[model samples]
Each structure stands twice: as structure tokens, then as C-alpha cells.
Target: MPTTGRVRHAAPGLGHSGVVTVTGQLGEFLRARRARLRPEDVGLGALPGRRRVTGLRREELAQLAGVSVSYYTRLEQGQSVNASDAVLDALAGALRLDDHERTHLRELASRRPRPLRRPPAERVNAMTLDLVRSMENVPTLVLGRRTDVLAWNPLGHALLASHLDPTAPERPADRPNVARMLFLDPHCRDLYVDWDRKARGVVANLRLIAGRHPEDALLASLVGELSVKSPEFVALWGDHRVKPCEGATYRLRHPLVGELTVTQQALSLPHSPEQSVLVVTAEQGSSSQDTLRLLGRFTVTS
Candidate 1:
């Protein structure tokens, strides 16, 4: 049985060696970036003419992060591969990395590369389809690990992806990944009021997903497309920011139902690691709720 859980993305450019895995690439990437940063960059004054290496010595960084020098060296060499989230956090602080770099570090350290799998002709299960069909009142969507819209309720189609051709969702070749839509789609760009914040979150979540599934060709393609189409996404990707996403308040300016404030929740299934069910709900009695209700009615009628 396929693991029914939200898929996590691996750190970018980590694939190399015999496997081209993110873990190896991440190790090399961190080593290179760390070597480029001078002692001055992290507020340490260089000792004149005595330093052998280009950047902060492994020992020095280990001292700052309060870890053993040998352990840190192993990490740089990709020998000590398994890293806890807390250790990654400590390294981020020791390196004086900004928010984006820190997130990237975590992604590189934590994400697992994907396995080769035959693309299922039908990925979404019948039970999931039934569940979405039953949710006529709330906007619900079933997304594959690659961010493909495998299934959605009618309102979900209208609320989240109105710009996509109706037939696109049903066709694997034509379908749009949610991450791709958020950054590459002009309509999606204009849908959110806080586009920048939303973009960061989207990129961060992508980072998380990429960390976990480095071999997913569909995901890699989506990343490549967004990198080419959206400069903001490109910049963010370069910075290597990453974060796990949960329920969050989002403001959407809908054309038909007017503006609505919604809380988006992602629910993962225990058996499927590559799938998640996301639902957007409005708070009770608020204008946003009224707006959502209106949108729901309009979507159903249409």
C-alpha cells in the first residue's frame, strides 16, 4: 500500500554521485557555501596571514555551535549524514545564516530522496473521490505528492483554481500543480492579497516536499517551470528557504463571490505518504463566510 501522507520535497541540487540524491548534494552545497563565507561575514576578525582555509575553520564553527569539531567535519564531508532538526538549527545559528539559508539547511539535512515508481494511471482512491463528492458545502481538494490536483469538490475548483481549464484537472498531462499555479499563473498571483508572504510559504512548502521526494520527475519539472516563469520564486529558491506548512489564514479576492478570508488546513492520510486533503473554511458569521457561501452557491449553480 502507498503511504498516505503529505509528500515532502528534498533540498535542491542535492542529487549527485551514484544516486544523485539530495542528501549528497546538500552536503556539498553546505560545504561550499560555508567555505565562501569569510570570518568577517560572521563577525569574526581574521587572524592576519595565519589562516590556512578560506573561511571559518571547522573547529571554529563547531565551537560556535557548541558541537564537537570532529562531528562538524564529518557533517561537512557528508559522513555524519543523519542530522536532527535541533542540530540543523544550531548550525544555522552558528553560521549566522539568514532565514532563507537556515530553512535550506534544514531541508538539505532532513529530506529523503524519492524512489522510482511507475506513474499510476489513477492515483486518487475511490474513497477519497467519494469524500470530496460529499463535501459540497466546503471547498476540499485532494492533491498528489507532486502537487497535482488529483481530485476536488466543485467549490474547491472554483475557490482555488478557477483559472485552470475545467478539463485540465482530469488530464494528467494538462493538470497544473498547485505550487506551479501559485507562482506561474497570473490569475493565481492576483488571487492572493498578500502575494509575497504567500509566495514564500509556497516556496518553503515546496522546499519541504522537494526534500522528501528528490526523484519525482513531475515535481522537478514544476520547479523548473516556476524558476523560469517567476523571478520571485527563482530568488526564493536560490536563497534555499524551507518550512513545513499547516493551516493558515489567507485572503482571497474572488471575482464572483467577492473577497473572502479562509483558513486552509492540510490533512494527510495515514496510508498514503504522497497525498493530502486540503480544505478551506471561513469563520462563522463573518463577512468572509458570507462571501464563501455566495461563492459556493455561484459555483454550484454554474
Candidate 2:
């Protein structure tokens, strides 16, 4: 891809403005992060003169990012656009950005000039519901493309969805979003002991999803709402972090059975691009396993 050119916008609307804003914000973020690091961080020779700034100068960053000083400057100023992924990666390396920052840079560079809004949420298919049912013993849940908890086995409902009203409709409008529940639900905050870490992880996963589906108005709206409601959520979102939540262990304090540790994994449904199944399990013979068994029994009785 060529390094120099202006990106063409299909129409003058929120989409176009969004792209420009994304690009400008990304450049500003990179510049700010880079300016905080010292030359020794990336093994560059120290300058003799008194340095005015803390980190690499713009010219030095251009040299490190492998673009012309003028071009890098324009990118930072939002003057030149259409940055390719390769260029962004190179710049990320030069800036010594961590994994989260690198992903953010790529996302910004790859953003479409005209982003589309997500359409209405569709109903989950029968087969998908059946799959969740089959995993009844395990805490299994089916999440929509926007990460809405569309369907879940009883155990899953008992484990995660318990934060929301059990009688709430399973539609996007009424359904409980995992991210929202994690931040907004008082029970969720109490359930997860390391609430801050878990909160950021949720935001980062949403960031990755948002980049892939930038036109998704529902996803954008969810993010926007969380940002306003939770100051911690707002701080993490502004960091421009990104990640896929494939697997992780979570400790939950169940009201009925006390504390339990469970390893949660996300599995993509082969037939549906808009659905995924999340399963949670405890290691055999562990105390957490006992708690899980007790919880399962309670669910059965209830």
C-alpha cells in the first residue's frame, strides 16, 4: 500500500467524521504515549543537547516508524490519511507500544472511511439453542455478535446472568449485555473479586469486537453508555485497548454456594457468524468443583 495519499469519503455524515476523528485520536494517542518514553527505552543513542520533551522527538519517531518526517507529521495532525496496517505496526514498534496499544494502532489505521450502523438484532436459531441446552451440566451461554447474552443454559443463567432480572426478555432491547452487567450490576462487582482487572478485560474484548464491526451502532451505543455510567469503564475505553476473550479463569461468589473458581472459554458457532457459545467449568475434585456441584443442585431444586 502506498504511504502517501488522502482517503476518499463516500458521503458526508457521521461515518466520515468518525473515521477522521478515529484517525486523529489515534495519532494523538501514539504521540502522547511515545513522548512519555525515553530514548534508552528502545536502545537509541542519547542526544547531547538539553531535551525539551521526555520521549522521542517527532523526527526521531519518523525515522523509527520508517516514514518521511512530513508524512508522519501530517498523520499526527490528521492532514494525511489512509494509513495501512503495515505502516501502523511499524510505527507501533518504533514507539515501543505494548500489546494493547499496538492493537489500538492497527484498529485506527484499518477503520473504514464510511462506517455503517448495525441492523436490528435477529432471533437465535433452534440448533443454537439446542446446543446450549445440551451443555446443561456446564454453564453455557450463547452470545450474539454484539456480545448480548441471547440464550444460556440454567447453570449459565445461575452463574452470570443472575445479575440481571431473571424475567427480562431475551431480546437485544431487553437482554443483558455481559459488559453492561459486569460494570452496572452491583452483584457483578461483588461476584468478581478483582473487579478492576475483569472490567478492563471486558472493555478490551469489546474494543476488539468494535473494531471488527465499527459500523455497529448498537455496539457503539453500548460502549458510549458504559463510558458515561462507569468512570472506571470510561478510563479503560479511552485507552483504546483491544483483545479477544478466548479463555480465562474467573472466581465468582455464588449467593447459594459461596466461592468457586471456573475456567471460561468462548467457542465460535460454525454455522452462525453472529453467535458464540461460552462455557465455564471447574477443575475436577477442587473445592470450587464442590461449590459448582452444590450450585447445580440448588438450581435443580429451585
Candidate 3:
């Protein structure tokens, strides 16, 4: 299962208010990464005596990263505030973090904690809306930073979420979040042929976004709601993976069209970097393409 991983301990320094600060989240990320490694995995031999800790001990990770044990412990405890680039890079290397995770680590370590505030609702510009609407053949939708469907062509809505109202995106309050639907809505969950892979990808993307916008109140609320409502979401989020939403080929089991494989590509807008237009396409002349055309016809007729 994509979500399979050791559950991480609750982030230290979380107070009665349960607000997670930037430094605290940074520490939590580090601890989660550290817990996934073992002594032999990093070229260190097993020490004598039965090991009590799950993965590498704090001292062991500190030794691997060439930092003092006490200093590393302080960092993990959210007591250290000024970790330099060199230190962060060393930690990333020690943990074997990929490019996305490395970037997330740096973002968490360097960001100043901000007071939680709801951001202005995301809106698709007229030019972008025009572009999306022009894609008559492709299944295309505009997604906000939180994976909210900001706008979608008729075919996009029919293919990805036909059960949802076609005009839901027009109302900010009624806009559907892809992540929420994937975990909580049975219709959305049944659409994916590989639900676990899609779920992990969604969670990983959310993790990266969370690192970048820690003070986003709406994002926090979405995460909190998912955590409480879905245990699978809790498991995936606790794994601390970070991935950018890029192009991927997915096998979808659409309710109306049955099974079809489509390549989903994300295009980021220059004016709105946080919002992306997702375009779904099938290989030319493939049966999936024929299926998509049929779905488009249904969308038009209905």
C-alpha cells in the first residue's frame, strides 16, 4: 500500500491550543524522515544490545549528519531556530531526501511562523478561463492551491466529477476540493483504478503545499477535517512525503465511461503560480480516446 509507513509520534511542543508552528512542523518532518531509516540502511553497523528505538536513534542520525547529538536533539525539540543551509543540506543528504522533500525541508526550516489567516478566494482569470473553455476535446480543469476546482470545461467535469453539479465551480462556497473528494467521497474514490497510488500522490502534494503555506487557514482546516474523518488520510499524511503535482498517467474507472487510461498534465499559470490547469488526454487513436469522445458527446447532449 502506498500509505504504508511507520506512524510518527505527535510533534513535540504542541500545546493545549494544538497550533503547529513552523519550527515545530520542521522538527516533525525531520523526526518522521529519521524514523524511516535504520543503522544498516545508512552504512552504520548495528550497535550492541537490543535497540529500543524504531529507526535510527537521535544520536545516530546526528552522527550521520555530522552534527552534535545535543544540537540535533535541540533541533528536533523545536528549540533551535536558525539552522543554516549547510546544516539543512547535510540533514537532507543524511536522510536521502529527494528534490521535492529537500525543498520542503528547507521551506519549513526557514519560514517565519505567521498568524493563521484565511486567504482571499482563488479566481481564474478571464484569459485562463477562455483557454480552459477552448479545450473542447480535452478534459481540462483549473485547480486552486488547495485542489479546489476553480473552473472546468464541460468535458472535464463530466469525466472527473460528473456526479457533482456542473456549475459548482462558479460558486466559491460550493467548489469541490479534489483531495477531500478522493478520501471522503465514494464516487470519487471509485473513479480511480489505483486508489492508493492516487491517494498518496494527493497527500504528498498537500504535504509540499503545507510546507510552503503553513499559515493558510483554509488549508489547515481541510487537513484537520480529513485527519478526523479519514484514517487512511491520517496514515498517508503522517508519512511526511512531499511531491509536486506534475504529469502522470492514470487509469480511471469513470462511472459513465467505464475504464480509460489518460495522461494528466498540470500547467501552472504565471500570474497565479499556486493555481494550475489540469489537462487530461488519451493517446491518439487509442480506445481511451474514443471513450473520451463518447463522454464528451454525452456531456454536450446532457
Candidate 4:
């Protein structure tokens, strides 16, 4: 899974990208997430004068979370590293964080430095490619550690992202991450009927991965790019939630198929925890299953 809820290292703050001390990241993520709130929205009484600052001020956030302003300021400033579960829970509640966001916050608070590893090759191996091909009727994809689309079966491409160039998965540099596509790509954006719920799931899943692979620079870069490009993503990331993306049923408004409900299941590769196969299907004997079966007729198996 994944999260804005990534790590603090020498990570550069929002806007300007590239490596910087991650020390400031927790604060930046907290500040950014907090900036989206309003006083009345959280049941705080409105002030008398013309308000200059946006969202809940740091002091207000601290107050709402049941902590002193100075300590919360320290935490936001990256000065406080001894965050406890109870404190994080309180803070998450104050910020209205979901389960995934809370996990991200915990991960951020507890991060320690490790030498960055050689960036992992995101290419799909021959065996994995072969396995994908074997699943002719299944809408399946091999996802890299960061959820990059490393490989896809013909039905997978047609059923999930037909609008995208089918060859995208072949290029490591240009590979598409399903999470990014969910928010940034128009076709992907319109695919899911419950957009907000889907978005939360994506963020939560990403947050979980962030905790597991803190030293992955590419993963960090993806989060940064998304943060800069999508305000919705930024807000969701700040919520610091984590979700294990095992399986879920989604109602999709597929452009070609009209409407369909499908259950998505992810199976981790035996040798590679970093990658997994995601398959989508409708219930047996259901009309949605009939529609899904119809999609296979148009599958591009080249």
C-alpha cells in the first residue's frame, strides 16, 4: 500500500522537488493537510476580525488535538521525535484522519535514516510476463513495488485503462502508477462511480507501502510529483491513513461497458513482495459477469 504519509529524511519540502532533509516533511505534510480546514468546519467559533490565515492555525490544531501549542509546534517543526501511539491517535482524530492516514503519521514520526538502496529495476521479468499472458480471460496486471504497472494482460489493459497507450508498461520511465492515474488521468478519474471512496483506498494503500519501503527514492518522488499536481491527493496523503489493499468490490462507470460492479483481488508474488497481481471480476451468474465476459472479446493480445 502507500501514503503523504511517507518519510522524513533529507526530503525537500513541497513545491520544489529533489532530495532534502526529511526532517521537515512531517511538519510540511501536517501543515498542508491542516491548511485545508476551516474553523467553523471543525466546530470552532468564528473570529471577529478579518482572518488572514487559511485552515486551522497551528495553535488551533494543537488545541483541538488536546496538546499544548508549543509541543505541537515542535512536532510540526520536526523537533519532536518521541511521538507515542496515543498522541498520534489524538492528533489523527483532531485532523479527521482515516485509518491509513493515522498509519502514515505513525510511520513519519518513527522514521530513522538508512542508506538509500540502488533503485530497483521496475521491469517485468520474462516469467512474470508469461504468467500475465497465460491469464487470457483475467483482467490482471503485475504492479511494481510502488504500484507501477509493470505488466498487464490483454484483458487487463482493455478493462482497466483502454484509453492509455497499451505499450506504456514496457517503458520503466513512463510506466503508469494506478494510484496516480486514479487522480490525474481523466479516463481513470471517470472510471470509478464512487470516486472519493476509491481515492481514499488508493491513498491508504500507498501509505501502507510508504511505511514498508521508506528508502525507496522513486516512491518518494512519485509522492512528491502527485502532491504538486493534485490537491485532492495532497489532502488525502496528509490524512496519514494506511490500508492493506487485499480485495474490494468497486462499482465502475466504464466508458465502453456502461456500469459494472467488480471485485478486485491482489495476490503478492511468491518471490517478490514488492510486486503483485491484481485481478478484477464480477460474481458468477451475474449480469456484471456477462458484461465482463463481453470485454474479453475485444481484448488486445499483442
Candidate 5:
């Protein structure tokens, strides 16, 4: 095959402004992934002369995946919706996607375009609320799929969002979304010592959720708002990264306690998979643990 330049075709359902429809997510993801890989990275020799495109060309990707260039182009252009499992698996393998990215690719490929609908308001069940309250030493909060704080214990509120009213999470409309705060709120941005890493992780997890719930109007709105307000968010979103919400260590510079290192873990609820209890804990016998105890006492007294 000649390494001639090919005319670029916009993916179907992409607007002039480059906004992608729910069904266009698969193509957008594929394009993003393809742009990140080099011919050499995929065991292909560099073509002669200057290349016009980034990463692997369409023909190269198709050849690597053992598929026709036309078929792969159509799949990447959002014209082929009913891709077989084997074909998708082949594409996943060719892209060298990780477990989370592989799952996200499958979700995007299988998703059907649907009218956006406002999902039911997420709530923290009474039992979950009780559980949060019981963990006095551990800073804990219940977060919805969109990273909305459904409920938070006193220590959790003190640890994460002390500037906001302690009871703000009780109201659905006024609830603080951690994603929004990380990008839009200055306080939240200052909270993390490594804001860039934290921000990227949040966006990656949100991308995974967006793939899993394409019909979620509120999630779409949140993404749009962030894209408009935060250039960092726009860049991260365009990277097509997907990650599950999991445990990670963070160094927080709290206005009240100064600084503390804590590991934050998200445990999904069995009855409500979209909701997770986020617990922040410091290692036992560490100075950070002592600081947490001090903060817990301050939260109770104040």
C-alpha cells in the first residue's frame, strides 16, 4: 500500500464546532487513541517522506488489526454501528488498551443514540447515611455517579469542603460535585498538592461514566460546562482516557489543619452501583493520622 496522503473525513454526527453526539463517542475515542500511537510503537516502519497525520494512519491501523481499510474507516467514522465482538476485540488489541479502556471501548461501540433524559435524583439511603455518620475518625462522603456529594459526615465536610455549608449536600440542587469543584472552585484546586494528577484522574473516571451512561443529560451538561470553563478539562477530555474510581493517595493542604496525606477510596454500593462511599484515611501512627484526629475534634466542637 502506498503511504499517500488521504483526505480527512469528519466522523459522522460531529458538529462544525467538533461537538460529538452520543453515538459519535466510539469514533471520537478511536480517533483519539489512534492519534496517540506511532507507527514504530505498533511495530511498523516509518513511511518515507513527511507524514501529514499523527500516530498510525487508517490503513496501517486496519492492516494491524487484520481488517480492510474501508471497513475500519467506516467503523471509525461512526458509519458502522453493529461491529462484531471479535472485530471490537481485535481493535482493542491493536490499540493496546488497558482493562478500563477496553471496557469503555466496548461500551461506546455498543451504545445506541437515545434522547437525553434527566436521570432520577440520586439520594443517600438512610442506612448509608448512618454508616457515614458512624465513621467519626474516617472522613467519609457518599458520591453519586457524577461525583455529586449525596451526603457527608461532619469530618468529611470539614476535610473536603469546609467553606460550604455542612448541610449543603442534603439539597439536590445545591450539592457540590467534586468534579466541578476540582475544575471550577479555587478552594478545591488549592486543596490538592498535586492538582494536575487529581484533576486528570477525575476527568478519566468521568469519561468512563459518560461511556457507560450516554443518555445521562446531566452528565452531558456537566461535561459541557467544564469544557467551556476549563481548558485543562477540555484537553483531558479529548485525550480519551478512561479509569475507574479507585483508591489513591493525596496530599491535602487544608486551611484548618495545614497539611495531611490521606488515601481516598471509593467503595460502590451493592444496591446502588452508581453511588459510592468515599472514605479518606491516613495511615495509622503517622503524623497525618494525628492531624486527622485533631481535625475530627475541631469538626465536632465547631
Candidate 6:
């Protein structure tokens, strides 16, 4: 019933230094969420006398979720692996997690992390390539789960990474990663007018992906490389922010054409949860549209 000084997880496979394992992430998330609430916020009256803990204590949270304190404590300690859907739902309700956070909670509590076993190239989708080829005038890209550029239209190459090889995405071994570019590439640094905002959004999307697939080796490598290469990325990743890579407006400072603003939309590939089509376009009738049209004068055909 008393609040412990801090909860410690005992799950195996924790990485060295700053890498957060699945179980460690789960416990930290729970601790962080639990510490942000007040007893009064959840209809519990503040107890008299100086309370040593913030938010709902472990016992109080367990009671609200209809679980024994010991059971909930074990789950937080990463000792429980086969948590039922009912218990997860109860905890989600008790924690008041939104839809995205609820999904994250379920994934983190599911079981031990295991690498996805598939062909080396399963992350690449042929149809995604065909789709990007059709988007001749649009800056279109097909991104792997780890944010690698699986495919990109000529316009996309010109608009986003013209300084790099236009055919970089064609070679599996030499694919250009947008996230890596966002943080580590000097050209990419100069491209974004608001680098901080773009960097934060990129890290947030990566956080969501990391929670879903903690055992992805390529993803882990990318994170480690960025953490070492970019202090900005290290700071952002530690924040545990999650965001869908949906649609957003981006202001770009292109060296050739000066500045232009465009909106980017990411559409998940059907039947392939890890691949997404990233397309960027300017608003119709705006100067950005005209600039983009001039910029995308080159086209690619299948």
C-alpha cells in the first residue's frame, strides 16, 4: 500500500547505456503516466498529512484497476508476461491513456520481445515501388519500417535529397534513411527551415515504431547511430513522445530554389503494416505550388 521509492524491472535483454528495452520502456511509461495524476483527479480525496508520493500510489492504482497490488506490482516489475486483454484494458482505463498510448501499453505488456523472422527483403514491397513510380510530379517515397527509403520518385529525389544520389534507394544496401538525414546529414540540416520542429516529429514517430517493434535490430542500430551522432536526437528520444507520421506542413530551404512550403502525407501500405507511402505536395493555387511545379520539372516513367 505504501509507495516504493522507485520501481525496478527485472526483464532480460536490456541493452547497454541509453537503449531502453521493451520491459524497461513499459515500466518507465507506467511510472511516468502514474506520476502525472493527482488523487483528486481520479475522484479519490486527498489524504490528510504530508503524502510522500505524487499521483496515485501503487496500491491505489491496483485497487482502481481491480487487480491485487502484488499482481500489478509484478507487472510493473516486468515479472508478468502473459497479461490478459481484460487486465490491460482495466489498466488502460485506470491510467486514462488515449488511443495511441493504449495501443502502446498493450504492445509493451504483451510478452518477451522477439525479432521478426522473415526474408531479408520482406520489408520492401514491390507494389510500393510501382505506386511511387506513378507519382511522377509528386515528391513520393516508400519508406521501410526503419525509415529507410525503399523507393522514391524522381521528383522526390530532387525535392528531398538532391544532394545525395538520386538512385540511392534502388540499392538495398545504400538506401537513404529520412530520419538519419533529418538528424545527421548536413544537407538535410540545411533543408529544413524549422529543423527543431521537424526533428521532434521524426523522433516522435520513431518512438512509436520502437514501442511496436522493440526487437527490430535495424531500428535499434539506427537509434544507436543517431544517439551517438546527434545530441538533438538523443534528447528527443528520451522524451518518450509518440506520434503518427500522418500529414503535416513543412517549410523547406532548398539551396537551388530558395524556400517553399509543402504538406506531407504518409499512407500505410495495405497488408504491410511496416511500409508507408510518403508523399509531399504544395497547396493548390499557392506560390509554393508554382515553385514545386518548377522544381519537379523532371519526371520518371515505368
The candidate that achieves the highest TM-score relative to the unseen native structure: 3
TM-score of candidate 1 against the unseen true structure? 0.74
> For candidate 2, lDDT tens digit of each residue in 108-153?
6666444444466757889988888888689998877767888888
Candidate structures ordered by TM-score, highest first: 3, 5, 2, 6, 1, 4
lDDT of 5 by residue, 1-302 (tens): 22212112222222213233655788889999999899999899876778989898888889889999999999988888789999989999999999999999998888776655567778778889889989988999999999999999889999999999988898999999999999999999999999999998998999998888766667777887787788888899888899987999999999988999999999988988899999999998999999999998998798
- TM-score, predicted candidate 4 vs. hidden true structure: 0.71
Per-residue lDDT tens digits for candidate 6, residues 219-291, read 6667767877777887777666678788899899988777999999999877788888899999989999898
lDDT score, residue 281, model 2? Answer: 94
lDDT of 3 by residue, 74-129 (tens): 99888898898999999999999999989998988888766555677888899999
Across residues 1-302, which tens digit of lDDT does each residue of candidate 4 receive? 32123333222332122333444657866886687789887998765677788788887888889999999999998888888888888888888887666766777778764544437567666878888888888899998878899889778988889988888898887787898899899999899888898899888788677666666766777777788788898878776556778899999888877899999899888777778889888999999998888887756423
Alpha-carbon lDDT, every model: 0.72, 0.73, 0.86, 0.77, 0.85, 0.77
Error of 4 at 45 (Å): 16
Backbone clash pairs for candidate 2 read: none
Determine which window of 10 residues in candidate 4 has minimal summed lDDT: 2-11
Ten residues in sequence with the least summed lDDT for candidate 3: 1-10
Q: Please give the TM-score that candidate 6 achieves against the real structure.
A: 0.81
User: lDDT: which candidate is best?
Assistant: 3
Off by over 4 Å in 5: 1-20
Candidate 3 vs. true structure, TM-score = 0.93
- Candidate 3 ranges with C-alpha deviation above 4 Å: 1-20
- Backbone clash pairs for candidate 3 read none
Segments in model 2 whose C-alpha atoms lie over 4 Å from true places: 1-20, 28-37, 46-57, 84-86, 96-107, 167-169
